[model samples]
Target: MTQDNVPVLTIDGPSGSGKGTITRLVAQRLGWHYLDSGALYRAVGIAAGWADLDLSDASALVRCTFDTDIDFQEDHGGEPRIIVNGLDATDELRTETAGAAASAIAAIPEVRAALRDRQRAYRRPPGLVADGRDMGTVIFPDAAYKVFLTASAEERAERRYKQLSEKGVSVTLPGLLREILARDARDANRAVAPLRPADDAVRIDTTGLPIDAVVARVLALMPAR
Candidate 1:
């Protein structure tokens, strides 16, 4: 797409900070395509695990990124289905094991480079809502609107616990809290594209705010449709 045709809104923050949920809602409201950048990393990690490739092997991971054909499909019901190499991996990608593995592999610079073009291709004519750790800062630095949504670590952990329990993935609240904090540290301190709010991004603290309230705040800050 040409420069004028590329319009995007990026929402970036630490994992379990409600960025994904909020970005999906915003995309639905605006009738735009949604890009869940984390899923790319998760799919790669799952593929590597299945192939018996070592997670620390950067070369193998980069090769897998190019070899994999990942698809994100949404039916009329508005539920996303992730397919990797013709295998439906929606459930597999959500497991805690997959999440941790994704975080580990995402820290590799070569893996990020391999997926950069794939992420950029999501920005099409209508628009896109991109969500990830470095969407605003690194992926779509020229995006029209950027938001960094965050909450207290405890609050985020509670939210994640409830979400996982609803999905039938058993998780302890304490363990989830620790994982969130650790993931935050790793994402922030990583040498390549560390997680942080872009200079022009609007930051929102959702610690005690309702989902609708946060959405409303975001809409108010966004450029008119």
Candidate 2:
């Protein structure tokens, strides 16, 4: 498909809302490219941490973002791999610390501006399924289909706790709940690209819904393939 006919599908939501999982499934089912925009931010955050730069320094972070050569690839097992400045950082970017740092730097206007073009370049021939806090509202406002998937804070916390535990990361339910709430506050209150559903986007509350149900609801909203 050409750029005009790329048929981008943007799934935007706060963290732990199953947007990532749903977007991957949708992209796989439709044989399209996937853009995990949050991973880009996380990679930048990891790079900044490695350089020991303060997240509040927007100018410095902007410079770092512009200079950073971040690459996203898939391993043989089909897992996403992140490379930062020619160094493999797939493991570093997945940590909670990196996630928190990403949230912090993502609030920086200059940093966002620097990474805008990089994010848009993911739109390829077969189309793309983009997932992030502002994928629909800001990154791809003209996306063919926009979905804002959300769940209750408690439900999201539970899901995150289970996921971390399964990965052998020790986490308490209360701690996870607090972290989720804090991240939500930061994401929604930030001045740049705050998290909100686009007016034209479909909203799906996955609090009591299964993953298949959410995927089905999103698929139903799409134009015929």
Candidate 3:
């Protein structure tokens, strides 16, 4: 299939809403390419910090974004490993600090413009499954299937606490909950590419659902290949 004809499935949601896990599983089931769009921003943030460039400097950030070398290698056993400038940045990219950096830079219109083409380049033949805050509304508006996964902030924070704890990272539930709320406000009110569901996107509440259940629900919404 041509690039234009390649199908795409977009799973958009806030951080810790289980979109990442669900998107990966859905892509694996269909044997399609996966784009962790959030990781791209995180990669940029990490690169900028290393170069001592201010996140508020749009020009510097755009340059830093272009100069950075970021790629994803699928491990199949779990999430794809993110490599930045030939270094394993997978673990670093998952930190709350990296996430906050990403959110800050993502609010810049120029930064988003610079990353737009890179995001689109992931849409290869067969199909693509994209996961991000604005995948459906902005990045992959033409996607064949779109899902907006969400849950209460309390539930999301609890989920994040569990995830971080499993990785041996210590965090307080109250602190995590506060961060989630703050992030929600920042993302939803951002001037450029604010987070919201596409008109045609399906909404799924995964508060108490298992991974398999959420994955199955999303897969059921997919168009037959």
Candidate 4:
């Protein structure tokens, strides 16, 4: 339900499909609040790693989720700083390692339930733009605009390579490709809130589309100013 006419636009997709960049841009244009749902899971994963907790331990993960201190700060020179348990994990959260950890944690049902309400809390007037694997399907099912952005694994991996490299994070294309494929399978097959498009979602294949074109396509679905 959209509370008090406060609308939401959900941009759900696999990693490196430009969800982060595209969603943030959309929110900025619309003057809406933004939520990066994946970051919540990533924050938990980061906290869990700091405490050395095993991923297989659901109870521990849930407890850690409750105890985790996660908050998003405004962009610091193009990169948003995420505070995880009092430490700035903005850089680490963008790594393939952090992505893998978030995927593992996302598959845990308890953790999903734990974060659902928190994600919903981001909804506010005049609106919200949320990006994540399950934002449209699960977190914000009633969103007025739902878009599933996707790209070929090779293309996405290449994009990730450039992104991380520019940020001084070393990564190889082949390794990223392999990891992306594995994460796709794991996310799609997860028992709870798997990564799949919402039935009503507008699908956009971003394989070779320019960012401006993609953003225009998404915004077209909304009421013109």
Candidate 5:
């Protein structure tokens, strides 16, 4: 059950599907808290890597996850910064390498169970907007609004490549497309909490939609406060 009258909007979709960007914008518009659950997993993955722990070792990963200090802080501009173990890991966590590690660790049932409660703690008064593979299906099952934002592999990859290029990161479109497809398969076929739209979720195909247009669509779907 929810802690109080606080409402929640869960946005779930495969990586590179634009759910992350949409969730943040919706949260800002509603003046609600935002939970980037994938960042938590990515932080754990980074920690595990630093500790020289094998990703296949569930127990080790769980230990590393709990031992790591992960927090999301907002800068003066209100941009979220991911901090892990007192180090700014925002950029590192966003890398495709960290994303792959997160996907692997996320498949571990124990890891998911360990982070479940931590994810729920973000639900404060007013509301919250959460984005992740299982936000709608698992984490925020009772959310007032559930959105599954998706796009074609080609489109998603193109968007990701463009973003990385703007950041001056050297990457190839074909490589990004391959990784997106592989990650999508892994997320959708995982044994526990596989990625899928909640039955009541609103599906939005954002293949060619502009950012503002998509944002407007989601805001329109929100219930009046």
Candidate 6:
């Protein structure tokens, strides 16, 4: 099928909302390509930081975005392995610092434009499952299925805390909660592609749902081919 004809399932949500996990599983179950749009911004931020490039410089940020090399490969367990400049950056990409950096640059119109085509290019063949804050409203509005996953800020903070703690990262619950709330406000009020659910999107509150249940719910929304 042509690129435009390829089916897409967009799962949009705030950080720690479980859209990332759900999108990956849905893509795997359907044997479709997956796009982690948030990671792209993080990759850019991480790369730029290494080069000592100022984040406030939009033109420079756009240049760095276009110049950086970002790739994704799945491990045996089906988790995405983020590669940047031929090196494994999966761990760094998941950090709160990286997340804040991503949120910082994501509000820039130029940077978002730079990554627009890159995200769209992932749609191929059978389909694509894209996960990001604005996937449904911005990147893949034409997608066959759109879902907006959400959870209470406190719950999201707890989920992130557990994940990071298990990874040996030191972080406090209150700090994470504060950061999540700040990011939410910034993302929803950003001038470019602000985060919001599409009018037709199916909303799922994954605050206390099991992974399997959330995945099944997302998959159930997919119509039969």
**lDDT per residue as tens, model 1, 1-225:** 684367798999888778888999998888888999999999999999999999999999999999988999976786899999999999999877888889888899999999999999888878899999889988899998999999999999999899889998889999999998998898889899988999999999999899998888887877776
Candidate 1: residue 4 Cα off by (Å): 5.3
Error of 1 at 122 (Å): 0.4
For candidate 6, list the clashing residue pairs, or say none. none
Candidate 6 stretches greater than 4 Å from native = 76-78
Ranking by TM-score: 6, 5, 3, 4, 1, 2
* CA lDDT, candidate 3, residue 69: 98
How does residue 182 of candidate 3 score in lDDT? 94
List ranges where model 1 is wrong by over 4 Å. 1-4
The number of the candidate with the highest lDDT is: 6
Error of 5 at 36 (Å): 0.4
- What is the Å distance of residue 210 in model 3 from its true position? 0.5
lDDT of 1: 0.90
- RMSD over all Cα atoms, model 1: 1.3
List where candidate 2 sits over 4 angstroms from the true fold.
none
What's the distance in Å from true for residue 139, model 4?
Answer: 0.9
Clashing pairs in 3: none
Q: Which candidate do you rate higher for TM-score, 1 or 6?
A: 6
- Which window of ten consecutive residues has the lowest lDDT sum in model 2? 90-99
Report the Cα lDDT for residue 122, model 1.
Answer: 89
TM-score of each: 0.96, 0.95, 0.97, 0.96, 0.97, 0.97
In the range 1-225, model 2's lDDT, one tens digit per residue, is 577678899999988899989999999888989999998899889888889998999988998898788888889999778889998998777667888999999999889988898999999978899999998899899998999999999999899888888888888989888888999999999999999999999999999899999989988987787
Reference-based lDDT, each prediction: 0.90, 0.90, 0.92, 0.91, 0.92, 0.93
For 52-77, candidate 6 gives per-residue lDDT tens digits of: 98989999999999999998897998
**How much is the lDDT of residue 222 in candidate 6?**
88
The residue ranges of model 5 lying beyond 4 angstroms of the native Cα positions read 1-4
| Candidate 5 C-alpha error for residue 176, in Å | 0.6
